[model samples]
Target: MVLQMSSNQANPNTYMGSVVASNDVVIQVNDLHKCYQSYPKPIHRLWQSFMPKRRFYQEFWALKGIDLTVHKGETVGIVGKNGSGKSTLLQVIAGILQPTKGSFTTKGRISALLELGAGFNPEFTGMENARLNASIMGLTREEFHDKLPDIVEFCGLGDFLHRPVKTYSSGMYVRLAFAVAINMNPDILIVDEALAVGDVRFQRQCFRRIEQLKEQGVSILFVTHSTESVIKYCDRAIMLDDGELKLTGSPKEVVQAYLELMFGSEKDTDALVKVDVENYKVEFDPSIDNCPKQASYNSGEHRWGDSRAKICYYEIFQNGAASNGLMQRGDQLVIRMWSLFEQDVDNLIYGITVKTNDGNAIYGTNSRALEVETPAQRAGDLVVVEFRLKLNLLAGDYFISLGVAQDHDVKDNIAIDRRYDLIHVHIRETLDAFGIADLEGDLSITLED
Candidate 1:
């Protein structure tokens, strides 16, 4: 496809600039833009070709004024809603698409696992396709043969590698593609939502390979809808919104902004009446401190919602006694939060979420999902909520998030009070476990002679 730029090169509205060069920089983008022309009908295209002076098509800019830089060994994540130019940007960087305006520079051999089956020939066998892809990535015949065993082992396609790629499943396609890309020893890797097609085990394996590549000083640009993956793997992240580069910061911060953009409403925070916490009266066990000063409370919690309700106090308990953030893996735990309402609200929902220290959500449930009835609350009403469950999770640092909202419907909910990462809990190890949760499998042995 041909790219066209606006006539005015020095327009004051444009972010016209160039990126500074550095030896450690693997990739640098400066004021990038990509535009596509749309014709109303096939006749319009013919007419446009004949009448060069007349405009018969409309222009749509898929990307505009994007600036980015990646240093060696850094993993940067791109996050956005659909049609946010994420794939377009990656395509431009991968040399599959040219920019309409602006410049970018890359220093090293690049390998990309972009759209599913992008570079594969369907008629070719999986093994043949692997060899072709490796050659395209600049590997010699001898070099590819040397790495063929590693590629085959990593993909685990086994006998399927000899079959035509057209017969491969989506998961198989991803496996073969990722295997070739990772084994190519690229200086820069660009992954665009390809791993989501793999099974859980393969995804874990791919991430491990990515970690190894990171240690070898490979710069990577990754794009996925999985915020948890971004937070867990990326050192930094950038958010794209409606073809514009919106925000760039830590992975957690960028994911938070992306989620807010997706779910946030324009409700006025000041319109909700504020509750006076000092005058709110509720009876609690005298031995436990429900205030924010409790040991389980996370001082750096992030909170946002309308001011109609407020979570005033919270506490954690184990075995009927208030406990700090530490607990055994199998212990039963209780989380309590007190919320004061300053206005009438109906169909209230109370929710809690358990997340890893890096913000990967482990478990979350709300009153609605549990079939618990919640009546309307009026001004000056105090509501206390308790969530109790066995800590079946593996030993790790975890955080608890709390929220209170008015369920308008299944799709729409009004957040009254929401606090993220409000409490920190550490699960102490007892028995050996491998994954996030212990399934408690029963063991049986069979003796054979």
Candidate 2:
């Protein structure tokens, strides 16, 4: 693997450079490109080697003209669909693979947990692999010993550490790997999807460690399919499409764009234009006359969709009366949403989500999950949906997101109309609860003679 020199030493287009000049920039990638040779058959590989320049294979570019910079303490998330070159870019940055055309520079020691058991020797014991990996990361014997206790405690592999790595389960493999990588004290951490293999407890532990590392000014490049994790942990995010850098921005914006790329269709724009014109002519129905005013509505709510269907009116009720955006904890509540269809649609799905003030989803449900079969509807038809449930939420401000979408077999639902955080509801104080929800626990005591 060749590391390109500074901009002065090499072509500016392909220069990776060291972190010598920039104090804050930890990782910089400029016009990076990577390609692989694809042969039609196994025999073609041998033929290509024998024929040399005689073109027995085609070039498959895995990365193309990727330019990125990671500042100190910045956690940049990489999100894309499968085969989008996420892993390829990371491998190049980690110096595990040589770039075919372009270059990228890294300032400090990088500890990457790219693939499961990637650096491990199957014949070696877990402890031996850990020592070898630590050494490879530039840790001395003293340093490795110093961190050994911490790694052992974190991984919780116990006696299994003496066993060959090939005998470990997928979860066990990630645990030991993560423990070593994080304990290496590198200035940059590159984590792929390896964290997904661990149990929830271990995952939480790893994230907590990652948060600590971020606070310590370690730049991190995280790649995952979980959009929620990106929104929750990342400062900025980049989306890739077909080996190309597509969009880069705040986490929410990038994730939204990625989702739109995945699930949104060209019809969305046309439907939105049509709905905007018809919205002015439509009048509110009398049934929802008591709906709360604009004060209860979230002005910063994000709304998008094809607009084939529009949520016209929405109201929340407690004790059979219109709610004023306030309700007691554990109160039985009713949520009503009215949608107007602008075009004929079938296999409709109505969904709702309850989220914290900080945008963490507490609970969500949809008609499809409840197995409610919805019939096809014609244009100009009005659909009213009512959801009745107990608001067992803790005392805090919460937001409700509503959506109407059409079912699709290949991907997620096609959004007819989706309103995120449209309604703001405040849960009044009640019996002490610790977390997001009140599970309503009961206590019993047995006396022994």
Candidate 3:
């Protein structure tokens, strides 16, 4: 029962299709609730005996009223802060835990690589553990026979494969476990942060394998704190807050929502280590912006073109993706618009702006630069504009605001879209190893003594 639905029509809000169907649902979770019992404090229990407050126990709802459907061959990601119940949901899906209120139906074989050493035996040798774990995963000898070579090669643990698992390092064990899971040929692959355990090269190798599976249309339900990876890898994502699914959309939207939560408390920190609060600012990259020569507008009937549409909300993401303040520099970010038009006018104009914390304009672009003219627009039309470009910014936070105009005059100038406050990114030396960034350049330097 793989959720398999092909798109016959494009969703108005997204470039991707909304092909959801009941028959196509490979995985379904309805009213899923997982709760944990919490005993009252000893003093509270004593006081309850004397004067109870109706109930004496407490319940922690790990998941509340969760309803999600995953179609076959779709790569979906789960994102949230710690304690947001992402791990709990994945556990129920993998049959590791039972939901108190509801259950999920999943089709086909599911191979889960969650916590490291979850299914391994420390007493057994690596080779023995592999076979033992494979059997636990419901893999037959014939299947393991076919996949053993791949597992060995992926792990690069030739000599150690037969050594006692108890003697292996944590890294070695993780490599072996991940290799076996990938070779299982699962219909559903649940990968937690298992890839993070191995070295950088190994991590990249695993990502490449996952990427290939994505090309082959394997259904993946991945959970990670890394928003950048989610945005880059997952076609869509859902954001969770306090055991509830809060938002579902493109990765950029979900990650931004998570960061705003982090910043709320982090704003008061006196630390300057990760982000220099005083130096933080956000804006569009001017290098990638094209000042328009003219503008377009939307009419009242929500026509394809005209002016007078006002934006209600929007978001910008780099590399066309993001994580909780973990985006990289020189990433290509996209801008999305969700607008509502009130009245029709002769002209309509829109622009995107990126600025620094000190109020310096890093970049700005609008329809005016396209050298186009539009007819008068009527009222009641809706508009959604999309812009994408490579962002060549130093790692830091910045803010963006949308610009609105009519007849070459500011009608509602500098309208507040969504704010990207202190979008955080880690500038690593390894970024030079991949992507198309100039990065000023990378080379192995040697001292000529």
Best by lDDT: 1
- Return the TM-score for candidate 3, rounded to 2 decimals: 0.57
lDDT of 1 by residue, 1-449 (tens): 01111112122111234433676876788889999999999999999999999999999999999989899899999999999999999888877788999987666777888888888889999999988877676678999999999999999999999999999999999999889888888888899999988999999999999999999998899999999999999999999988899999999999878866665545665555554445544554322235567888888887767757778788788978899989887788898888877677788899999998878898999999999999999876787899998888888889999999878654367777788899988988666566678788678899999
> What TM-score would candidate 1 get against the native?
0.84
lDDT of candidates 1 onward, in order: 0.83, 0.82, 0.62
Judging by lDDT, tell me the better candidate of 1 and 2: 1
Q: Which ten residues in a row have the lowest lDDT in candidate 1?
A: 1-10
Global CA lDDT computed for model 2: 0.82
- Model 2: per-residue Cα lDDT over 1-449, one tens digit each: 10111122222212344333476877888788999999899999999789997998899999999989989899999999999999999888887788887667777777888887788898999999988887776678998899999999999999999999999999999999888888888788899998988999999999999999999998899999988899889999999999999999999888877877777745534542233333434356522322345467887777788877778788788878887788888788898888877788899999999988876788899999999999887766777899887898888999998889989987768887888888898988766566678888788899999
Q: Across residues 145-246, which tens digit of lDDT does each residue of candidate 3 receive? A: 888889889989988998888888778877887787777767678887776667888888888999987777667898887766786788778888899999
Model 2 is weakest, by summed lDDT over 10 consecutive residues, at 1-10
lDDT score for residue 101 of model 2: 79
Question: RMSD for each model, in Å, please?
Answer: 6.1, 4.9, 16.3
* Residue 19 lDDT, candidate 3, scale 0-100: 28
Regions of candidate 1 where Cα sits further than 4 Å from its true position: 1-20, 266-270, 274-280, 283-291, 324-329, 342-348, 376-381, 392-396, 406-415, 426-449
Best by TM-score: 2
